[model samples]
Target chain A: MSAVVITVTSGKGGVGKTTATANISTALAAMGKKVVAIDADIGLRNLDVVMGLENRIVYNLVDVVEGTCRLRQAMIKDKYLPELYLIPAAQSRDKTALTPGDMIELTNQMREDFDYILIDSPAGIEQGFKNAIAPADRVLIVTTPEVSAVRDADRIIGLIEAEGKYSSDLVVNRVRVDLVRRGDMLSTEDVVDVLAISLIGVVPDDESIIISTNQGRPAVLQNGSLAGQAFRDIAARLTGQTVPFMELDGHDSFMKRLSKLFKL
Target chain B: MPNDRIKIKGTSNGLVITLGAGAWPRLVEELDALLGERASFFKGGRVALRVGARLLSTADIEAVGQVLSKHHVTLWAVESEAEETRTAAAELGLEVELEPRPISPEQSRPTAGDTILIRRTLRSGQVVEFPGNVVVIGDVNPGAEIRAGGNVVVWGRLRGAVHAGMNEELGEMAVVCALDMSPSHLRIGDYLALSPADDSRTQIVPEMAFVHDRQIVAEPWSV
Candidate 1:
């Protein structure tokens, strides 16, 4: 089956692009799809660690691109899911070691074997980011609710549109419901209004995500985690499933709930 | 010196680099050397190359563009007297003439009639500048900017910075109007004003801004 290459990027750093890539790849694989995750952040490679495939990486994306190893040899199979694989980045090399042409060729060769190829793009609008999106069929931009993050996301959306490749979807991460309720943080509607893109997912700020990430197990594997559910829903939406967004305000005051009920 | 063959001057739109009369190879080499010498000053700057009466081919224009781009400068327009050069520049998506055409001696008097129309949203980091009035049919998000020599009008939301009557010689007669006026910064000639801090949550309504008593003021659009 042909694979749909999707690139996950954010102009600002520490916006959970790597986490989204790892969890979304896991969630898609759990759905019985053959998924291949590529870490396009060469010098700061962390997708392999997040995916729990760090120690198993014998070869990397640079190796495959440089012809030192075959594409199959560089792919590290997931310990839990038999259908999931990850092509880790070369920690010793930088972005210049791989070009956009190399990424396009690599994804094309693997298109016949996988159902979805998810690329975790590095932060910034540099060569690494270009390489990640070179072969993308769709783009997912992750950003926090902060003004700086939203502004960067807006710039990234403009850049992606200028490329004329694929339409991008937005995933607002690290959203604290209490802060939003207090009017101290930007809501999903505010971010969407500024970026003017379709909202694909809204991941709440959950402590379980940090714990699960440290354990080398993505939060999506945890059934009770809210962020995990968001990722799962995002994957479903990616597969053309229309899953309604989950209500993040679980601790809404009675007056607020009454107001909402009365308005309806 | 060979560097004297290339002259760079700052204009209202951007830098205008004039290539002196010489062979194409010599002119190109001198231009590259001049850019390399002042790379830091020219970094992230837009430029228009003026090649007087030269019949430059597409490849020649492209070569000049490549050199400028390497120095972190954008070649947005090409001003040339030759038809062939203008056609080559247009083929490469560069403007054939500099923007905000210079007023002739007979038409030196400033008028607020000429305007440029834009039909799309101006996202963050986008800038629209014109010599005459500007009318936008879409939203201007935060961080986007619009600078005009005369009045400015937005049929949609205008939440970005806008400078109307950029040419101070035209006096403070320019006005700015928008369906939802909440600009980060508003300017009329030399006067500048910021949106009130508490106006963010206010309901959207049609408004007009202009210079009143040497200060920028905004009022509900009536006429």
Candidate 2:
């Protein structure tokens, strides 16, 4: 099957790109689709840790590109998901180890085997970001509800549009429903209005994410986590499923409404 | 093309170099050699350029700047009859026109009657700079900027920072108008005015900003 490459990038760092990549790829794999996630950040490699595949990465993206190892040797199988694999980044190398051509070549080799190839792109609009988007059929720009994040997202969208190749979809992460209800934080609509891109996911700010991240387990594996469900919904949407958008602030529980009304 | 179309003249300000009609690369090479011939005399000197109808890109203008800077020369002002060259110069933060000095009066015509028109939404990090009048047919998003030597007009919402009369000579004559004007700030030549907090952005009002009594002011645009 031909794999659809989706590069997840945010212009600014620390906006949950790695976390989203880990969770979304896990969710997509758990859906029984053969998926492989590539960690494009060479020096600051963490997608391996987030995906719980760090120890299994005997061969990495750099090794595959540098001819030190075969492409299949670098593909690390996930712990429980038999259909999922990860091409981890080299911890010892910088982003220059792999060029855009190398990334395109790697994805081309894997396209015949996997149904979806999720590229966990490094932050910034530098060489790493370019290499990540080089083979992308579509791009997912992750941003938080903050103005700085949104502004950076706009610049990324502008850059992608300047390339005029891949279609960009926005995934707004870490949305605080409480702050939005209190009018202190930006809402999804506000972010979408400013960004003017199609929304794929709206993950609420959940503390379980931090616990899950440290445990080397994505929240998508959790049953009751709202953020986990959001990732699943994003995966379903990616497969052309008409999954309803998450009701982060809406469909609030009775207790949630009471707290919001009391705050108002 | 012929010999060298480069004419360098000394004015009250450092220098006024007029670039006549020729291929852009050839003109740039000629300018580099001409400045290199007397590097010591041009050291720490500011010069204004007059390129008549030579449509140049932002990179092209910066190439010229780099060629001049190689010889310790500062290319400050760029007076071009072409709208593209002027916009490129203005985008580079160089003065589109000199400070009301006797610039090249013999270069076909001035940029007074010229205007640049952009028909796209200027997103963040995108800029629109023009020597004369500028008319944008789309929204100017936040973090985007427009620096105009003359009047500025936006057909859509203007939510970015915009400066009119950047050349300072037309400070009083320049007026910036927009439909739904809620810019981050407004500037007219040397004067700056932080946009008044426009809370009621829902109600659209076409307004014009101009310098009056040494202060920048915005009023409803009736004309």
Candidate 3:
């Protein structure tokens, strides 16, 4: 089956684009679908480390484009999921090393072999951003519930529309159910109303996500974490399933509620 | 193909056509030939033709005016340091006054009273202004703004800032409603309302906001 290239991007940094690419790729592959995750942040490579495949980098995306290696040689298989692979970005080189044409061509070739291609886009609306979206069949914007993040997401959505490309969606990451319940944070409705785009997934703020990231195991691997379920639901939706968003209303921590009560 | 024509520049006030040197009959003939070639471009256009000291009788000015009229163009005024051309233009009922300066906004702010509808959400950092009603079918994100002289309507949530009836008092109302109503600030006339905490577990339904007792108050949208 041909791959569907989806770019995960956020205009603001540290909004978890790389983590999303890793987790979504792993989850889709776990479902017996062949997936390839491409780290489009050429200079600042982090997807490899997050996916626990940092040590096995012989050929990178630059090598594949520059004819130093075949496309197959550059794809590093995942540690646990054999159906998943990652085409790591070049750590030593900068974003200018690869052109948008290179990215488009690489993704086109990979599409013939894999069922899904997830691109981890770098932050900002620069050359890196262009390279990431140049080959995408769909774009998933990741943003938190904060005002600043939503603001940046708005700007990115405008730019995407300006480029004459349509069919883009939004995913609100790291939502706190407790804060939302207490009216201290923006809820899913708040973000959707502001962004005015179709919502695909809403991931809750689970501390287990941080622990999983540090250990090079994406939270999606746990199969029980609420955030992991969210990612899986997102993958299912991407595959044309009508999975509803995983509800996080019952998981609000007692301490979180207590802090809200004391603050008010 | 006739290069014997005067060149014209368009300004807000009128057109300025610079005359070329030639025999009187030849010049008139050339002007006629030139206007004929591009009649559509100059149709219904008002012109101030500049002829530099070319001696002309009333007949010459009449001939030029006739040629201009044939192309549906009006000769508004004549520009020249030449005394004779000015006298001829004044004799032909055309104004001899200097070209008028462009009217600035200080001279006019005539409201057309036209309104523009924005069908998409006004996201953060997006600003829109209208002299009349501003209707938005989507959300107005925080840090975004909508300034209108008449009224404002938001079909979705409005968590951003908005100002209505900017030039007047609370006469012009600002209404913002969404499935979830939360705004950084909402202003109508002189009244402003800072957003309160959102209510979760409450299925957000459509709501409408308006100025109440010099403050912004929201009510559930009903028929």
Candidate 4:
């Protein structure tokens, strides 16, 4: 079956691009779909560590692109899900090592074998980012609720549109609803107002998410993680399932819940 | 020396860089250096090239195109006197010639009373600069910038930096207005005004900004 190549990108670093890629791919795989994740950040390879496939990477994306190894040789099977795989980036090489054509060629070979190919793009709008987006059938822009992240997401949306890729869904990650309720942080609406894009997911800031990430078990596989549920909802939407946006606050005051309910 | 070899003129289509007779490689190097100096101005711009009587192969035109692309400029058409140069440019799918705007004594410069209408959003890091007035029909996000020699107007939200009456002696006469007047900063001629650090206004109103008493002041638009 042909796979839909979805490039997950964030213009600003530290905005959960790699984390989202790992979790979303894992969630999709757990749903009985074949999935693969490619880390396009060559020099700063972290997706392997995030995916807990660091030790399993003998051949990388550069090796596959340079024909030093077979494409199947570079695919590292996921630890938690048999249906998921990851093509790690080459830690020693820079973004210049892989061209846009190489990325397109690599994804094209994987398309026949997988249901979804999620490319974790580098932080900047450089060669790495371009390579990741060149073959994308869809784009998912990840951003935090902060103004800088939202602004960068807007910039990424513009660049994607310029590339003739018309559709991009926004993923607001690491949002602190407490701060948002206190009127201290930007709300999801504020971000969507500035970005003017479709909101696919809003992953709340959770301490357990960091813990699960450190253990190489993405929170999506965890039992009681709010961020995990948010990513699961994202995956559910991706698979053509209608999942409503979950309430981030489990302990919101009754007044707040009532107001939210009324608004909905 | 570079100015003598290379000349930049803005036509109705876009900027045109006219190259004097020289060795191909040296001319290309000179053009690259000139563009690198004003890289920001040329970025996201599409320009034509006028190679006077100089024969170019497809590779030569492509080499120049590579240089322009390095600076985020696009080479769309090539104006050449030599038939060989025109044929090479055409072979590479470049327009051999643009519909020339005849120059007149009164219209020696195309900037006079000229205004460009931009119909799309200017996202972060996108910039629009013109020697005449500028009007944008969409929002200008925070890292975007607009520079105009005359008046500036945005029909939607404007939250970017804008410089009106840019490099013009009649800078104070240039006015800037938008439906929402939130901007990073405003510059009219030499005057500068910084937006407040906190955006407390929940309501958005169409406001016009102009220089008053040697300072830029924005007021709610009237009429």
Best by DockQ: 4
Instruction: Say which prediction, candidate 2 or candidate 3, comes out ahead on TM-score.
Output: 2
Please state the CAPRI-style docking class of candidate 3. incorrect
Q: Candidate 2 regions off by >4 Å?
A: A251-264, B1-57, B60-120, B166-171, B196-204
* Structure candidate 4, residue pairs in collision: none
Write candidate 3's Cα lDDT for A82-130 as tens digits.
8999999999898988766578778877788889999999999888888
Q: Residue A41 lDDT in model 2?
A: 92
Clash pairs for candidate 3: B156-B178
Candidate 1 lDDT over residue span B1-223, tens digit each: 4545578888887799987643465467768888888889999999998888655767888998898889999998889765446655765767777876564423532235566677666767767666678899888888889988888999998989999998767648899999999999998898899988987555777999988887888889775
lDDT of 3 at B92: 62
Tens-digit lDDT string for candidate 2 (A180-258):
9899999999988877789999998888899999989999998767788899999999999999886665736834754
**lDDT digits (tens) for residues A1-264 of candidate 4:** 999999999999999999999999999999999999999999999899888889888999999988999999999999889999999999998999987757876888889989999999999987888888878988999999998888888888877764546669999999998899899999999998888778999998888789987988899998567788889999999988989887776545633664666687
lDDT of 1 by residue, A92-208 (tens): 999989876578779989999999999999999888988887688899999999999988887787666544443799999999999999999999999988788889999988888
Candidate 1 vs candidate 3: which has greater lDDT? 1
Q: Which structure among the candidates has the greatest TM-score?
A: 4
TM-score of chain B of 3: 0.47
RMSD of each: 11.0, 11.6, 17.9, 10.5
- Specify the CAPRI tier of model 1: incorrect
Q: Give the TM-score of candidate 2.
A: 0.73
* lDDT (Cα) of model 3: 0.78
Residue B165, model 3: lDDT of 68
Stretches > 4 Å off in candidate 4: A249-264, B1-112, B167-170, B200-202
